[model samples]
Target: MTTPTDFLLWVRGPGFDIALVVFILGVIIRLLEVLVLGRKHDYSEPRGGELGPGLKTVVTRTLPETGSFKRAPFTVIGGYIWHIGFFISLFLFVPHIELINATLGLSWPGIASNLVDAVAAVTIVTLIAMLFSRLTHPVKRYLSGPEDYLTWLVTFLPMLTGYLAYHRMIDPYPLVLGLHILSVEVLMIVFPFTKLMHAFTFFIARWYNGAMSGRRGVQS
Candidate 1:
């Protein structure tokens, strides 16, 4: 039988490498598809400039409009909490920072592990709540499909496994750690093909829409 050590080694080595390759290649191919499908040439005369409006929209779109917030207070607030908590847990954790530094030759100071733990716990709760909301809300439930739920599962697993690993809630440290790494690998592998691609494409889309509107002298 394979030992926990073996499982850990495989995940850290071959498993991570495979996931990384798929993540990179998939992202590149998808991005190329989008970029290659260049928009139709606009013959209309430009009233202003595309660059300024595009940049402005990119910044403004980070927050919901007042009307949107009023309409979906839980979504807007919960989304903010999830994003903030996820970022803090991902970036400010010491082990994650060290891993990033080793992999990418980038380094940054990390916050307290306890703080990261708190954030991770909050993020996990927020994700669960979001899933519940999606399941119950008429419009969201109507639009939901397999990919949406799969995306949520893949996204949730990494955090849940990582938290469990950190707390050593599972038996055998190596096994738990291996599971955490594998969960992250799963997340990476599915990211480019799923709704998670919005992490990258959302900004590009917002900019494109804003730029077109700006060219027409309309505030996006």
Candidate 2:
């Protein structure tokens, strides 16, 4: 008979192994394709330095520009809150910190559980609000399609499952916990192939834009 403990063990062992393998290999392949698939010669004379602006933009774009913030204050502000909260919960929560310590032999002090829980809830709320805005806003609605919604759900599910598991909201706690871990595995497998690549490509795209614009004597 399949027990909750068995389910949890499989998720933590084989499921995790599969997810990590796929995530890492897929990411590497995708990166190689992006970086190696295209090349061109730009013979135009330089009007300004490229490296400085490239580095600058990599840092600067993390904060919304004045015009962007003015145009989308809610998005800009909400994005910051969501990002900060999500990262804090992911990195600083006790369980996650302990997992890192166990797996990688690195350790750090985690924040209080209550604080992390509060941040997680807030980030989840922000994500929901952002999704609602996307659905309601005319421009965003027009631009978004099924993939956007699908990505949103997949991205959101791990957090939801993790929260539920942590709180033991359902019976068979081990099963629920396994579900959470499995949800994360699903996310990892899909991440490299989805818009989630933006987590990495954002820097490259910003740098290229900044460098090109700098060469054109414009600050981007």
Candidate 3:
């Protein structure tokens, strides 16, 4: 049987290192495009206001009252939960935490293993629910593009494979581990080119909306 130490060594080797590099670079490039190219348009325009009106009102409104939260409550809630849960699982998973500790000399306190496992389970279920809602809800269905479906698959595969790998449900750790890594690698390579780009764009978009509303003296 391959020991955990051997598995860790594999993760620390060239394949994992290259995948990490690609993920980081992809995210950075995507963010630059969103910040630089996405800013060329005048977001103060009426059409732009439709994209995020509550953001526009941020300067005048208390943070809690941002209409964005109210306008599309379910979408916002689901999105937030999925993102937070995904990030927590990604960073807190034992192997990842160990890697960070080893490579960067940093470690975050983590929840108990069982609790963390529960959270991962919840995250996966919530994400699946969210994807289903997007497909079934008329308004969401109308708004979703092909890229949306693709993104869901790309994101789902990694979480699912990671869970399977961690649980060791099917013996042969190598196969499950390889699947998890492959899913992640695919996600990393495609990140900058898909709707997943929103992860980087959302903050910039919010700030732009806020600035525009402030400049126009309009209640956001």
Quality of model 3 by C-alpha lDDT: 0.74
Q: Arrange candidates by TM-score, descending.
A: 1, 2, 3
Tens-place lDDT digits, model 3, residues 103-141: 899998766777667878888998898988998999889
lDDT of each: 0.94, 0.89, 0.74
Using lDDT as the measure, the top candidate is: 1
Residue 208, candidate 1: how far off, in angstroms? 0.5
Residue 34 in candidate 2, Cα distance off native in Å? 0.9
lDDT-better candidate, 1 vs 3: 1
**Better structure of 1 and 2 per lDDT:** 1
Listing every candidate in turn, what is its Cα RMSD in Å to the true structure after a full C-alpha superposition? 0.9, 1.6, 5.7
Candidate 3 — number of clashing residue pairs?
Answer: 1
Q: In model 3, which residue pairs have backbone atoms overlapping below 3 Å?
A: 57-220
Which of the two, 2 or 3, has more lDDT? Answer: 2
State the displacement of the C-alpha of residue 161, model 3, in Å, after optimal TM-score superposition: 1.2
